[model samples]
Each structure stands twice: as C-alpha cells, then as structure tokens.
Target: MIAVDPEEGRVRLSTAATEDRELWQFLKGLQKGEILSGTVASIESFGVFVALDDGPRHPVFSGVGFITFPELSWRRFEDPSEVVEVGQRVSCEFLQFDTRNGEARLSLRALQPDPFATFADDTEVGQTLSGRVTKLLPFGAFVQVADGIEGLVHLSELARTPVETPEEVVQVGDQVSIVVMEIDVERRRLLLSLRHA
Candidate 1:
C-alpha cells in the first residue's frame, strides 16, 4: 500500500512482495518452545547473532535471530566462542518474537538437560560439598560445586568470626568446603554455608 500527499509531496509505502509475505508468514508460524536450526552469523561480547535457515531478514539489523549469554549454553562460559563459533550450525529453542526489533530470542541451553535440576534431585540440604570459588561480591561469594551449578555463600555464613568482606576469608579459585544451607528448586538458587561446613 502506498499513500501520497500531493500538497506536501510526501509518500508512504506499506506493502510486501509475495516472497516477503511468505517469509513473514514463516517467521510468524514459529512459536515459543519450538526448536529451530540456524548458522552462527556472528559473535559479540553481549550475545550471538544467528542467521536462521528459514526466517526472514530482520527489519532492522542484518540478522533476525539472537541468543543472549545465559541462553547460549548450559555451562558457565566467559566467552560465547567457547560454545559456538561463526558459521557453526546450531539448534536453539525459540524463546519469543521481538516484534519491535524484528528478531527471535532463542536459547541454545534449552535443548540440553539442566544441570541444576539434576544437582537438586541428587543433593539435599546440609550436605557438605567441595567447591571452587568462582566469584566474590561485597555480600557473598559464588562457589561452583558442579560443572554448571553455583551456590551463594552469604557474608554471614562465610565464617564464625565477623568479616567485612568475602575476600578477607576466600578469594577466587580457592577450593572451599561448603554446606548446602537451603535450596529453592523453583527459583534454582542454592544457599551455602562455609561456617557450618
């Protein structure tokens, strides 16, 4: 559809060709939770861009697909390249259609079994586990007990003696013994206690 204003000499175009319509229809048919295959178009610090095999070009960007850091893989990785490379074929679960941006939010991890689910099923509260300190914050430290599972050891749980920060007692890459204080399975959060361990 094209509209013109003779007085202002302005024009607007709103129609698509048959192929464009078909492409859009195909994109529209995709639903959340559906798995789709695509090639890795590029990798950025923030996310990975995919060129979907049967999807339309983004109305804005060069690609119509995207996968954020957390959605890239089941395991924790510092870089996207560790899990996928440019030109690699991948299967991802469609998360949602970003109508405003004309892109699909996809998750590569959805195709894999959740490590947390398995961890929770086999573990119980008060279980002592050995872990490596992966990160430290003002309030707590994140300890990786399993390949992809991390638990938080709050400042209060760090030691029997009072401490101002986690760094006072533990640093990154330190092997620590921690007790599982609480588990919120629905939320996928694990609370650990270094003092109790």
Candidate 2:
C-alpha cells in the first residue's frame, strides 16, 4: 500500500498484502477517544512506542502508536521504563492521529481511574492534609497532597498577613500542613491555605 501527503512532500510505502479497500477504510475509521490494544514495542526517555494490533503501520518508526511520559501512567515516575516495558501489552486511549509524524498519540493513563477524583471524594474543603512542597512559583507553592495529586497554596493564603512570594513562607521539599480552601472538581484544581492549617 502507498500513501502520500502532498503538503508534507512525504511518501509512505507498505509491502504487507491486504485488501486495499479495507485498509483505506480502516485508516479513515479511526477516531480520537477510541481504545486500542498494543504491545510495547520500545521504551524511550521521552515516551513509549507501541505496535498496535489492527492499526496502520507508521511510515518512519517501528510502531504506529506513541504515549508521552505524562500519559504513561497516573502516578509520577522518574523514568518511562518504571511504568512500561518492551513487549508488555497495554490498552491506551487514542488521543489523536499525529498526521505530521504519522503516529497515533496514545494515553495509557486514561485507562486508569483519576486519583484526583478519588481524593476529592474522600476529602472536602476545610480539611487539613500534610504534604511536601513540590514546587514554588511566584504566585504560590505546589504541594503534593497525595500520589499524582498536587494542590496550589496561593501567596495570599500562605500567611495571615500579606506576603510577597511563596518563598517567604515555604520552600521546595518543605513539609507543611495545608487546609483545603476550595476544590474545583471540574478543573481538577485544589486551592489550599497554609495560614488556616
């Protein structure tokens, strides 16, 4: 089979014998949000590549499917290999067709339940949770309340009095107790108050 993208000035050729009509129709039928299964073809520092079953072959790479680091798993990990390994089977949500690169943008994390949803269900505003400061920004500090879940403690909420920056009250890696001020479930954002805690 042969496919050409005139705008990109690229041509792709596949030697596998298959029904031309079926192949073309199958390629056209794929849509975003579809769940597909594939084997982990390779693991890279940036992402994991999957050779999807019943999917079109990629023109340049070994696999037609790719999952970025953030999409690999629900929990944060130091490396991609920590979440997936070569030859391991995985089901991923098809995020989009990377027409420019001719690969499917897959998300393995989508198949798993969101930790934020669970956290919100278990906790409410006015509750206090102990967390370590993961990042400090000019506006506020980010505290990890649970695995894969982080809340922002706004600068105004950091102290009883006005503060210039988050650094005045907290630093990265500092253990602090934070009170949940607001929980925006739709946005998946947790507004915390260090002063109230």
Candidate 3:
C-alpha cells in the first residue's frame, strides 16, 4: 500500500507500474557504468526522456530512462535539441536507478572523453589563449576556451578599470585574448583573466 486514509475509508494501493515485478527486474539488471541503448522519446527544458530498448515501459513518464541536461553532452548548449533529437538512437552510460522518478539516470557524456581533462593536461597557468565569450553575467563572463571547455573571467578581471557588467568589456561571441589565472582540477574549474592578457 502506498497511502492510507482509514477515517475516510479510502486506501491508495500499489497500482503504479513501477511497483510491479518487471520494474524491479529491470532495475536489478542495471549496473552503473553499463551501456544502454535507447531512442530519445522526448526532450524537455529540464532533461531528455529515453525509451530504453530493453526496459519495461515507465509507469508515469514517457520512457524508463532519463538524461539530465548536463549529462547530454560535455559541450554547453542553449537548447536540449542541440545535443539530441526525438527518435534519435543513442548509447549512454547508466548512472543509477532514480527511485524518486522511477527511471534510470543515464549520461550521454560519459560515453565521450572529457575535454576538460585533456585541456588541463596540456594547459597551464599564465598561458595566453584566445576564446570566444559565451555568456555574460553580473559577476563574470563565461568564455569557451576549447571544445566543451569554458572558463570564467570575473568582473574584476574583465578590465583593468572597474566595470559594472561584462557588457562593459565584452559581449557574447566576441573573440578575446585571456590569460589562464587558475586551473582547479579538483573543482573542475578554470579561471581566466582578460585584464592580465
């Protein structure tokens, strides 16, 4: 029984398909790091739903597999479609069984190499590199230094002069030269500075 209300003589029994034997059987068969193939069932602002080729149909969701936006790819994208389209076949790494959502959390990026790791392996602090501005915020601007790699240039580092916003120095898509101020592999962060360039 999922819920009960004795005074009202009402009971919510386990009718959800996720509570069925098939779901448990599918989940039990899943192991983290295992590859799963599926078709993209739907794409939402939050994530993409995948219809696993081997799993039972989901109880409530459109598919039994789910991939969050970040897991879609290592590269940044403005829309989910930029990474995948509905009905497209894809292979993903099974992250875990998401009990709350009754779906398996999957990652498409896990099947690809991490560009940040390669960038860190070859790059160093004080190295000057050119990048295109990708986003502007009150605190900083994000610049794409390499494929699937971005670094933050804080407001203070945008210019030698005090600036109110990143727009004061750069705009989205502007090519700018920057110096590597820090590369924190532990935190997976890369800090850049235009002023020091």
Best by TM-score: 3
Candidate order by decreasing TM-score = 3, 1, 2
**How far in Å is the alpha carbon of 85 misplaced in model 3?**
1.0
User: In candidate 2, what are the lDDT values of residues 117-186, reduced to their tens digit?
Assistant: 9999999899999999999999999999998899999999999999998889998999999999999989
C-alpha TM-score for every candidate = 0.82, 0.76, 0.84
Q: Write the per-residue lDDT of candidate 3 for residues 127-192, one digit (tens) a residue.
A: 999999999999999999998899999999999999998998999999999999999987889999
Roughly what TM-score does model 3 have, to 2 decimal places?
Answer: 0.84
Q: What is candidate 1's lDDT per residue for 1-197, written digit by digit as tens? A: 13467799887654332236545676678888998898998887667889898887754344568899999887878778899999999999999875544568899999999888999999999899999999999999999999989999999999999999999999999999999999888898999999998
RMSD of every candidate to native, in Å, equals 7.0, 5.3, 5.3
Displacement of residue 38 (Cα, Å) in model 1 is 1.4
- In model 1, the Cα lDDT at residue 177 comes to 97
Off by over 4 Å in 2: 1-25, 43-47, 76-79
lDDT winner, 2 or 3: 3
Query: Candidate 1: where is the Cα deviation over 4 Å?
Result: 1-20, 57-60
Which residue pairs overlap in candidate 1's backbone?
none
Full-model lDDT, candidate 2: 0.84
